[model samples]
Target: MFIYQKLRDSILKRQLAPGNQLVESVISDKLNVGRTPIRGAIRKLAEEGLVNVIPNRGAFVIQPTKEEIVQAYEIRMELEQLAARLAVPYMDETDYEHMQRLCDEEGETIQSSDFRAYLQVNKDFHMTYIRKCANMFLIEFAERMIDQTNIYLMLYEMVFFHTSPQTAPGAAEHRELIQIFRDRNEELAGMKVRSHIANAMKSLQIDNIQFSNLGDIF
Candidate 1:
């Protein structure tokens, strides 16, 4: 358990760092653990996409690339667009208040520059509606994909979008999304949600998504 936590946190915190080799003998020596559990933990990390285990060659940490980040955001945009439309009929005052609080908390976290906290609040904000949309299939599908894609999103934000989360298209954008939910304007809400998602990537200079002109990456 300790070895597992240590290795997982090292990847998340990037202590072990990306592309670094995870030599079991070295880890066993460093953490004073046996090879059995160390191997077990590496397999788990590999399953999560945090580490890529190569046969004969040892595990290496994931280095989230630009293409991977774009793919993840694309997947999220589709899920959230559907979720935005589905959540309208189900939303009540309680849901509104909860979402409002999350938006506010997200702003506060941005102000404080608590990156982890801001990310957590942001995920919570999205998941709140996602879980309430009452479509178990959509909910489960989003959860599974987001769980994997979120790691790449974190890498992108940390590496590329830095303090933007504190400024324009961050908290203000979140507030607008909340209002869209309040309006229960399903089509408009979906459009706005899609725009919000694309805009985030636009900041990174990746403006080549032609829905009509589909490509290989699709």
Candidate 2:
């Protein structure tokens, strides 16, 4: 999984921007590994929807459209709202304590500006509620939508990084959501879940304009 990890980390760190060519030979030389592992890594990335492999052309990082990104968040808003509402009734005292610990960890990671740690804890924070949802189908479906949005954000987050301190506020929002859950205010918690998505979408967007740099969807 070395090649896979390298490619994923490169994309996450923005060393390889969206739509950057992932040539097998180039990767093999760059990573000083064999072509077999490089191809395997590319295949894995393609399977994960992080890269698109054209039949005749080589693999390139997947760059979803801004419209696609926004639409994904819209769907995520509904899914997360449902999750929050359902998760509140099932969660126990242990769950709340565990969530509180994660929120604390998230705050520390954000303060350190460890983007990777922040992203990891962010997923953990949502999945904590998502896993408690009554509906298995809803959980799986929500995860897929979240993954799609995350791929875009991971690669195209310079606009977000340059503007506000996005990570810290998001950690604070998780704490807010957790508190709402603790209060057993299902309806309000659901509203807050949707608001979280809305705020994330707005924060992700460029203030004045954004370039729709997406090329052909290979």
Candidate 3:
């Protein structure tokens, strides 16, 4: 479990660059763990879409293609729209307040140039209404898509740090979503969900981008 957490954090934080192989023996020596545990940890990461295990080859950090990211967001948009429709009836004052607080916190992260912190808050904002859906199957699938998008965002959205404040993403849209939810209009909520995700997906242009190799496959 410790190895899994370490490897997961490394991938999520971009400490382990995409397409880098999870070389068993090298990782074993570096983490002071054996090959068995490293293999186990890698399998876990692969299950989470953070790593790709290729048969006859080896495990590597997932280097998601632009098509993959866009497809994931398209699926996410449909699921989130459904989630918003179902979630609105269950949403209460506390959920609304929490979402607003997260939106505010996100703005602070932008000011401080704390991108990792912003990603966490952004995840919380979506999960706030998402959890209210009360459908475990939908919730699980939706969360997976969120995780994938977060990873994509982590790889791309860091560009915000060097750009103008006016160009910073999500905060305005989140505030708008918060109001839509407060209105308790499920139809409008679903429409907003579609636009919200579409806009986020549009911002990430991964075309022709190359990742630096961190390690080779054994």
Candidates in order: C-alpha RMSD to true structure: 8.3, 4.8, 3.4
TM-score of each: 0.79, 0.83, 0.79
- Model 1 off-target regions past 4 Å? 159-168, 202-218
Alpha carbon deviation, residue 141, candidate 1 (Å): 1.4
lDDT of 1 by residue, 122-217 (tens): 778878878877899888887766666657544434422345444646577778878888888988877887787777655543222121110111
Question: Which 10 residues in a row give candidate 1 its minimum summed lDDT?
Answer: 209-218
TM-score of 1: 0.79
Tens digits of per-residue lDDT, candidate 2, 109-154, equal 6566676676777777888898899999999999888877777667
- Cα lDDT computed for each candidate against the true fold: 0.71, 0.76, 0.82
Q: List the residue pairs that clash in candidate 2.
A: none
lDDT of 2: 0.76
Candidates ranked, most accurate by lDDT first: 3, 2, 1
Task: Identify the leading candidate in terms of TM-score.
Answer: 2
Q: Per-residue lDDT for 61 in model 1?
A: 73
Q: Which candidate is the best by lDDT?
A: 3
Candidate 1 residue 24 C-alpha distance from true site, Å: 1.0
The 10 consecutive residues of candidate 3 with the worst lDDT sum are: 209-218
- TM-score order of candidates, top first: 2, 3, 1
